[model samples]
Target: MTIQLPTEIWWRILDYLPSNKVKQLGRVNRAFLEKARQSRYQSLVIYEYDKKTKRRLKKIRSSSLGHYVRSLTLCVQAWPASDLIRWDGQTGDSLSVVDRVRSLFDSHYLPRKTVALKKKRLDRRIELIFEAMTAFEHIQEYELIWEEYDQDCPEEFIPEVKFASSLMTIFLSMLVISPLRGTLTKLSLQIPTHIALDCLAAADFPFLEDLKVFLWKSQCSRAKDWDILTGYLGSENLAKFISGLSSTLQTLSISRLDPSINLDRDFGRVFDLLCRTNFPFLRSFDFCTRSRYLRKGTPSLDRFVRQISHSVRSLKLSHLAYDTSSSSPLHHLDHRSWISNVLSVQGLQTRAFSSLTSLRIKDGSLSAHLADLSALLTSVAHQLVSFFLEDNLLTLKEVETVVCSLSHSSSPLRYLGIEPRDLAPDTFDLLVCAFPGLRELSLSFERFTSSDDDVIPMTEEDVRCMFPNLCLDLGFFCFGLMNTAGATADGIICLRLRSAVSLEIELCLMR
Candidate 1:
């Protein structure tokens, strides 16, 4: 007896199987193999070190499987130092394996697929791969990842050395070739800081609509080298890079290796470059730091705030703090001036976040720059609809002021998240009154015991009387509750009574 299954069911089952297993199933029988080789399995990955596997992949690329593959990733392991010195010699065992792997990609069997090439060797292999990929007529997305080598390596006897050197050369070649620029809409490139500066200064990606660049800093070096490297990434280079991009870019994210580097004047230059560029279609911008340094003469937070306030619709500020130093004056007039500039009334109007709807401020406790932040928020309260102040040092008065200000705004705010440390009973009551139309609320509070008299004395009846038509999120407060009742006009109250008081209560009393 033969059993017939629906096509949809068969595809669904195949979806759960691993790619290697799916490839095996395709080799099971002609009928099963044909269906398995469909476009549903379009993504392919070829590794250079895996000789037997890549050779088989090459065969598949030439067969019917080639027509179905839409996305391909090429990962070649970095050849060890021993392999580098032996390159001039006759074809060794490792070199032969590398050749076999390179042949598969060089064949150009699946030219239409999106290609991701990760290089472990910096040599001719990379150039060959790019040359082959360029032949494809319908490639759309391309990504390149290379191991960053900044310091001179000590002598080693490891195999695959030649491959590693080759990989580096491949990465350098990409900067000049610019093959993936015009066709790619979304591009992510992980480049060394030195090469990143070079690419920023020289290359232009006209058709790139979304770009994510991770610039890894070189190994710590002398001050002169740092200056030279940073000077290459000055405002001019930044402007050139942005100018080269298509005016249709919708999202831009610029990040630095060290949060301390973000405070450098070069960061301000990059910001200026972005502003000068024509990104009229841009809707989202994110600039973040991994940590903060309070070095003297560093660009203040106000400069960054001013740069992004106009065009960014969603903003996130994280890991802010002043670098500790005994030599540098902790309380300088310039520091005060910077703070004043960030909170300046004139700057607020000039860079009013008129388009801003979502704002997230994290790690404010370490930074003593709350005054400027308040001023900034006060300026843009008219347009904000979703505000999140997480893990910040906000007093009850400041919390009440911000909430009241937002309530007075004509904008329709639907979501609000405030830490519990910033709230008192009076402030909490003020929040409900100010944002009557709130749909979601998250509050984080300190430890609360059952015996504590200062607990929010909110009964089910009180909740029903207060928020008759709204959803209540009491999860963050850790308020212990027993009987929570929900009532309707019919006079019957649906009481959800928890038998015992637990550590936390998440009550949604629907009326």
Candidate 2:
């Protein structure tokens, strides 16, 4: 007798089984094995530490698991000696402990773990990890996280290691050599600049639609190396890379470049390359930096904005504060103005983005520049559905002006986020009125003051008075007074109206 079931039912049952278990069931018979092989698994996670209890994973020949995988996360834990301090006066030698761990890792024959380095050995360890990653044939998304190790007096035996930086270079090298380019949809290189450039030059991910490159502060101090780094990312090379990318690449994010390094010429060249390139599918753009403005005017910023004006649908601008001194009022204002000018110009462009639906501005104020920003918002508000402004300096009145501009338009905007100071009563009402289709709203209120009668009851009259168009998804956080009756009730009604809408209410009670 044989068990006969519908194919759909079998697939549904198989979905309930773990990958390892599915593999086990596959070995039970040929039918099970074929079904298991056909299953489309979406995520693959490879960790540095081996599980204490090891179970045998099915070894299938000639079958690549890459096609089914959508996302990949790699976590590498470098030995931390300081974490192993004993309560007694006697302290464990950090290097000796690391050596013991390395020895145990060496015992394993796994490809990624095969290259276990001796204590204080950095280069060899990185090599081994790269060798192991070569087996992954198709990878759509990749994440690399390297833990830092402490350098205490007792741990002097451990070499002053830049392990993360070295590891990044090796990973980039693998991307160049790997045949996974065509299938690679998203590539995130969280490494230093040199390695990122090297990887960019090595392979062309024709299907690469999204790219995020993170450059950390490198201790390497040679003018020649810096020149080489920039040289690799020159206009010609960038053009070649984009051209080879099957014309599918869209979103690009570069982080943490040296602030002192003048980005005007380089960014201009990049903008030219992108403008010349045909990105029919490009829709979103994000530019973030920790560097300060070396020159007074932000030509690079303006040029970059102009280049992408026609295509960008979703945009995010973030500036990282390097130090307290670097956070001077003048410098901060300069950065804000540069960003504002770009937004204003882009908004005014005749060939505006028709597909833009979402916009986010972070860590800077858009108030002083709201008039310019309002022009941009008015241009795209018709198609815009979500807008987020976090940690920006804006007064209640300014926020209302922008919201009023957006509301007047016949746009589909349903979600709005603003900083704490911008959430005044009048401004809140204005936002609710403007985005009639609004399903989600987030407010960061700096101070919420109320007189003696804080918790006022809401009648039908009040509801109509507050919001004539009552349908919305409300998320509110008040930094001052917690007692606001109608606010909470209105929030509940908004949540109940739309199943898709999410509401969050936080009241900061006054002391």
Scored by TM-score, the top model is 2
- Measured against the true structure, the TM-scores of the candidates, in listed sequence, are 0.61, 0.68
Q: Model 2: per-residue lDDT, tens digit, 413-463?
A: 877776545234455456656765666666655444332244333333443
Q: How close is candidate 1 to the true structure, as a TM-score?
A: 0.61
Quantify all predictions' global Cα lDDT against the true fold.
0.50, 0.55
Off by over 4 Å in 1: 1-60, 63-124, 135-140, 145-169, 175-179, 220-238, 259-262, 272-275, 291-310, 319-347, 363-368, 409-411, 420-431, 436-477, 480-511
**Cα misplacement distance, residue 511 of candidate 2 (Å):** 8.6
